[model samples]
Structures are given as C-alpha cells and as structure tokens.
Target: MPKTTAQLRQLWRAYECNEAEMAAIGFGPDRIRVARPAARAFTALAETMTRYRYFIRPADTDSYNCRTITGGTLKSLHAYGIALDVNWSTNPYVDHPGTRGPRFSPKPTQAERALDVKAGRADTDMTEAMIAEIESLCTATGLQLFKWGGHFGTLKDSMHFELDIGPDDLAGGLASR
Candidate 1:
C-alpha cells in the first residue's frame, strides 16, 4: 500500500530519524543518499520509510569503512555487502588525530554543512533506533543485521548494516527468521 507522510514520519521517529549523521565518507555532498542494497533492504524492512518520502540518496562506493579512523579494525560490513553509510560529508572511517570536532561530528564548515543539510532528505545516520529498525527488518526477513557499531566502542559507524550469516543462506534466511 502507499504510505502517507505521517506514516513515514512515524516510522522514522520510531527508528530515531532525527539523530541523522552529518554527511561524511561514502556520502557525497548530498546527505540524502543510500546504497542500492541498503535501500532495498530498508524498503523490504519498512516501505513506509520510502513511501511518498523521497529523502534517501545514493552514497559513493569508496570510503566505506571505519578503519580510516581507527587504523586497526576488523573488515567493514560494506566489504561483505551488508553495510552502508549515510550523509557522509567527510570520511569518518579515517583516523584524524587532534581534531577539534567530535569523532562523528556533523560537518562544521558552511560548505560541508550545507551539502549535508541538502542531502538529509534521502540519507540517514545509523542511530541506535535506525539500527534497531534494521535489526527488526532483518529479524522479520530472516537476515542477520551485522553492525560496525556493535563491535567497536570508541567509534560507532552509524550508517553501516549487513547480514552476518554466510553467503549460501543470505537471502533464504530473510523468510525463515
């Protein structure tokens, strides 16, 4: 069925949409971007988020991991085709020492900030609520939602989500669990 703005807003609220991440790596100047896989998964999880509301955009291919920021870390969910970042104004995955802004702080400059604000409609920061929504969707679909925020403490890549299960069972599980 078609979704109303209210319905999309409601689902977004439940998933904590207000706390969207500022545009950073993978995300171009436009913050309203999402990967094909993430968008498909998101739609499968909750069509309401996509119904009538076209605020999600497509993210870039490179700069998808947190290793750039932490240096020593495990492979990113993007590497396994289960994760994606949103509204990336800068590369949060990169390690920036002595930086004044927060680890995942929203863009500070006017140009960077403007780019992020403009793209926010289509993209989203992987907040706890967002993660919960993805997890819920994965649970309903029988797909495992593996997150970078789950393992790391210092850096929680909010825009990342993927299936932890092996390849042979990636899609089938979506119907089982």
Candidate 2:
C-alpha cells in the first residue's frame, strides 16, 4: 500500500514490532519469526510446508533483521519485522542482467545453476513446484498483501517474502483480530 520508498520506511517505523510481537512458526529448528499481524498466514504456510515435507533448515530461515537491502539504500521490510527469508541457503538471491551483472538466465541449465549455487550467486532448491506451491498457498491464505521477491524482474530473491501493506492497514487488520 505504500506508494514510495519513503512512505514504506515511515510505515515500517510506525508499525515496527518487537520480538514479543512476533510469532515463531515451523517445526523444531526449521522456524522463522513473523509479525503478530501476519502470524496466522505464516503459521498456515509453515503447516503446509510441513504437510508437503518441504525442506527448510533453521540456518536458512530468518526474519526481523534491522538492516537495509543487501546492496541498496532502501530499508528492508525485515527491519520492520514483517519480512521473512526461508531456506535462503537453497533459495539464493540472483541478479540478472542488471547492476550486479548477468548471473541468472531465464532458462538456465542444471549445470549452470549448480555452478551458480556453488559460486554463491544463486540457489538450486527453489524448483518450479516449490514456487508454484508457495504462490498458491499465499493466494489461498488471505495473504494477498504479501509479496514474493521471486517476482522481481531483474533480481531473483526467491528466499524472501514480505507483507506489502502499509502501517495503517496492518494496524487495522491487527485491530480487527
């Protein structure tokens, strides 16, 4: 719902939740934190992943980092405790033909993908099936405001997910709950 980066940042500051406002979801070590407003959606996601036997390791799952984007000046949604990165070890972020150079091809060969993964340039575990399942789950869980970074045109951050709504909307939704 934020129209600009500044607006988004403002929203993040306004609605930024602490650890107590977060919910830990997933099984055993394969867990991640999400804002209370988004707990239900993420819980459902975790349950579905468990039901489908999706692979998500603790070291690869994280949330609520107070930092900017990897290489940009914009504040990350994780700084607001609303973004999550699942299985980042296997769902690496890749840059296409952009500022970071051409590391990702639209249709890459398995060998190329393997090399990319080894070189820390991309991931290999986020298969088409996984992507499809996650997208479908998000659509069905009333998490329409959550955006997947895999949809980025030039940058493929397949491990990332965040609620795209503004602070007021998020607060309102929480109030309704």
Candidate 3:
C-alpha cells in the first residue's frame, strides 16, 4: 500500500527517533513539504529497516549541518532533502587502531569527513542489494527513487532515498490540502 506522511512518521518513531529528527529527514521545515510519493518511499525504507534491525542512525552534528559534497568538496544530497545516513557504522568511515598498540598505521581521518568526497565511498558503502530492496518496495508503491548509493560510486546508504523533484512539486497532490 502507498504510505502517507503519518505512516512515515510512525515508522521513524518505531526506530526510537524523536520528532525533530524525523522532521529534518522529512524536510518538513523546508519550503517544500514531503510528497506523498516520497512519504511512501520513506515508509518502504522504514519497513526495510526491520530487516536490518531498525538500523537507521541519526545524522551527526557535522552531517546535519554538512555543506559540502562530492568527495568532501561539493554539496551533498543531504543539503537538498534528498538523502540520509543509515547506521552510523557506514557513514563516518572511522579509522581505528590496529592490532599493534600505538605503533599502528594512522587511522583514516578527514578534515571533517572530508574523505567522503574524493571517493564515492560514502555511496558505495551502502551496498547495491540493500538499496535495490528499498527501491523495489518503493517502486511497488509507485514511488520514484533518488538514491546516492545507486548512482554514485562511493558509500552506499541503502536506507537513503528520495524523490527526484523538489518541494515545489510536492505542494500539489497529497500535500496541498
């Protein structure tokens, strides 16, 4: 069944997130309201999350305010209300210590996750199979997907997807009351 905004919000709450974060992910504060199609897509993603143990992570402060994209150099889909991070394990790409004590090689560090840009690692980390599942469910509900994990070569955030159009298009249809 197609998902409504209320359904999407409920799904997010199932993951133990608060309303504020949900609002950010839904782009509710932006000029554009979340479209029904996109809401359907988000609901599918939430259902998909059950498989991964309700595994969506909140955006870190940096990611929340992140302004750069494309290898840490350009603006990211997050800034556009088109993307989100799943499970923190994959997003930051932390480099921890090795078997050796302090003698280990330097862990991967970025100016501020700056490494996320140079390589498509961010989108790539999300895995195509997972993204496909979300896409499949979304498509079944007639929702178009815009996933960074699919189109980009970097990290793959299977949980992340949105409508290709902007908020302007969302005004009509289910959102226009």
lDDT (10s digit) by residue, model 3, range 129-167: 445565554233344444433332333333344444434
Give the top-scoring candidate (lDDT): 2
Candidate 1 per-residue lDDT, tens place, 19-114, comes to 232123222223222233334343343342333232334543232232322353443334323344543443233322343322221543434533
Off by over 4 Å in 2: 1-10, 98-123, 138-145, 166-177
- The TM-scores of all predictions, comma-separated, are 0.41, 0.67, 0.42
What TM-score does candidate 1 get on C-alpha atoms? Answer: 0.41
Model 2 TM-score on a 0 to 1 scale: 0.67
Better of 2 and 3 by lDDT: 2
Per-residue lDDT for 22-48 in model 2, tens only? 666664356667666666656655665
How much lDDT does each candidate structure score? 0.36, 0.61, 0.38
Worst 10 residues of 2 by lDDT: 99-108
